[model samples]
Target: MPADQLTDLLDPARWDPLPHPPAMEYPLPVRRRDPRTLPPAPATGSAPEVLSRGADGVLLRLRHRAPRARAVALHASGWWRPQPADALDLVPAGDGWWEIVLEAPADWRTSYGFVEHDGPGDPPWWEAGLKAPGAPVHPDALCAHRHGAARGGAERSVLSLPFDGLFRAGRDDAETPAEVHELPLGPDAPRVRWWVPEEAGPAPLPLLVVTDGAEHVEQLGTPERLRRGVEAGVLPPLVAVFVDAGEHRGDVLGVPGGQARWIPEDLVPRLRAAGLTAPGGRRLALTDDPARTIITGASYGGLTALFTAARAPGTIGIAIAQSVSLWRYPRGALVGPLREAAGYAPLRLRLHAGRFEGSMAADARALADALDGSGAEVTLDLHSGGHDWAWWQPALLHDLAAELGR
Candidate 1:
């Protein structure tokens, strides 16, 4: 079945509704537009319009004006993977317009794009891999809200709905912002971007070690959010360390190999030795207690966070893993180690997975079930979106507020 059709199998009634924004209509009426006339393509940088809303979800019409293309397909994160058969076909409407209407939860958010195929039977460029040469995905010209550059600097378009309070902690206007510092550890090590909260005191603060540092900082604006979160008193004052994975991300991130050794063994010691100091010349220190140390990441980075916690419980005690690629390893392979670690010492974990993530969502549930009775304080948050940074950013802020709230 096509990716859009597969979504029809999901009953939104099964999932609880996300908190609604103030004075919003329960079921929004269809916009006033002529049925015969196609809605004009949104201006560049503007989001695609929500056509209508119903009890099931919202109706979003994705349009591509590709007159010469043989076929056009919608490629949204979590909706369509590498499989060509799963591609959401956009039917020819009128003129040069090719469009498809998607029914999604009101709180749904994701990055998407359209692909123009040479032939009807052509496979998606992503089948070869995002980094493959000539596999660039075309961003939606209409929708301007982009998230994360991939496939040789090609950014994906964003579609965000109202999800109240999920990102409320990060205020745009803040009196005091956290100070950011770049630390080049060595030629062999990943560069670290450190965020030291202005509220830093004499006492050692909790540390948050984030994997895929560049994406978290550049794409997600996590440091700014963390600063806002601290200033608002929604989160406790702490130090954030963003670890740049570079090209070797695939080699060292998720796999229980180099990252397992480097984080606790090399990175932590080096940071301690450097003695991070705030802009005010107040010497900032990191807590030695594992319970005060938190590690987080998304996708493969998420898997790495859990793996690192299990391997070095004495170094990391809390893990906030989002959209973890638990399917990477053989079934029960990663879970076994975490279960063993929990038996020795209790670990606090926040596991997030999207309902649209298919097998990854199942794997997250399985991991949560396996951790039961293992003495780990685990909370599983099944969100309404996909495996995109659109959800990951707000979800990260939500986790920080819940876990380390003042």
Candidate 2:
């Protein structure tokens, strides 16, 4: 049952909780663009304003005008689907302008757009208001930056709320260079990127395995952060291995044994042969003391990190999960077994979740409590943020310091 639980968790189809946005749902009802009914982009659009901040969330006011719209609504990535309750009715603010005010978490940063509808049955008119030329598509781009296809094959806008959390800035001046390695898991396997802190001296370095390797390296600045951490002595020198999920990320990182097999059977051997050390200059081994190995990730990646620690106890001594999807199906499959694994290997964990992530946040805390007497050391923290990179980027930095500083 325990082994099956791990395999069940690895089932990719079961992992993703949020469906792709409506815009991404292709073959959308086609309607001829009626110039009279088409919304003429918003004018004088800067960014939404933070009208007020309170205990619940932040109140935001966004102004635009769709002369033809009988109804308007706000849509964002986090919501499962754009609900009628999320609809924003345009109120005449004068001079052909209308405004809609919505409340969002203080740390919410995501792609969004204002959709206009002509009638009850009319198809939605997607409009990303006038963005400054080369301004990176504003007021609606889905994120500050996007990778792969924009959701829905339709361009939305970007909305980033103000956050004052402390995230150490990465250093670009470090002489250490990052390297990319290929893991031949077939032609479709995720690409690999790594950085070995030779600067940590002759001793073999510890290893930090990051899921979602490509984005963390390119978008989230993982390599730069590692470089900065080593040079600043904030974290001990370590070999950082980033795993890319490619198209099958859901199958690879989201599922339970997906990462377990790849890391131990595939990644570890490759790193060992490449002269990457697991403490004491020894080749990487699951049977090693385990304390020297760390696996970390956010969201589904976070979920996988915990499973990896349990599935390959001798290989991973520590797991750092950020905003993990504990609220998903087979919800407590991993947690339940971890609590009952009588001879489970000694492991340490650092968990970080967002106060705004609702149930997932609560689940993370509960997960930590569940592990209290299970022979694993655990720490859970709730930061004022959301499920996006804006929160995880800095949180990862802090998690590293906590683990490698030991």
In terms of TM-score, the best-performing candidate is 1
Task: Name the runs in model 2 displaced over 4 angstroms.
Answer: 1-48, 51-59, 62-72, 79-103, 107-189, 196-201, 218-221, 224-237, 276-289, 323-331, 340-344, 352-359, 362-366, 382-387
- Model 2 over residues 1-406: C-alpha lDDT tens digits? 3544544444455444444223222111111122223344345445566667787577677666567666555544444222243244445556655666656766666545555555665333332211111122223321233322232234444455644223432212333445444444466446776665545565657778888876766544567667667777787777788888676666676555577567865677666556544345644322234688888888779978876776666667788888887655454666654553324567788888875454667788778877777777888877654455645666677777876677
- Scanning candidate 1 in windows of ten residues, the lowest lDDT window is 23-32
For 294-352, candidate 1 gives per-residue lDDT tens digits of 88888878988887777666678889999887666556666656766666565888899
* Reference-based lDDT, each prediction: 0.68, 0.59
Q: Each candidate's root-mean-square deviation in Å?
A: 11.6, 9.0
Clashes of each: 1, 11
Assess every candidate by TM-score.
0.75, 0.63
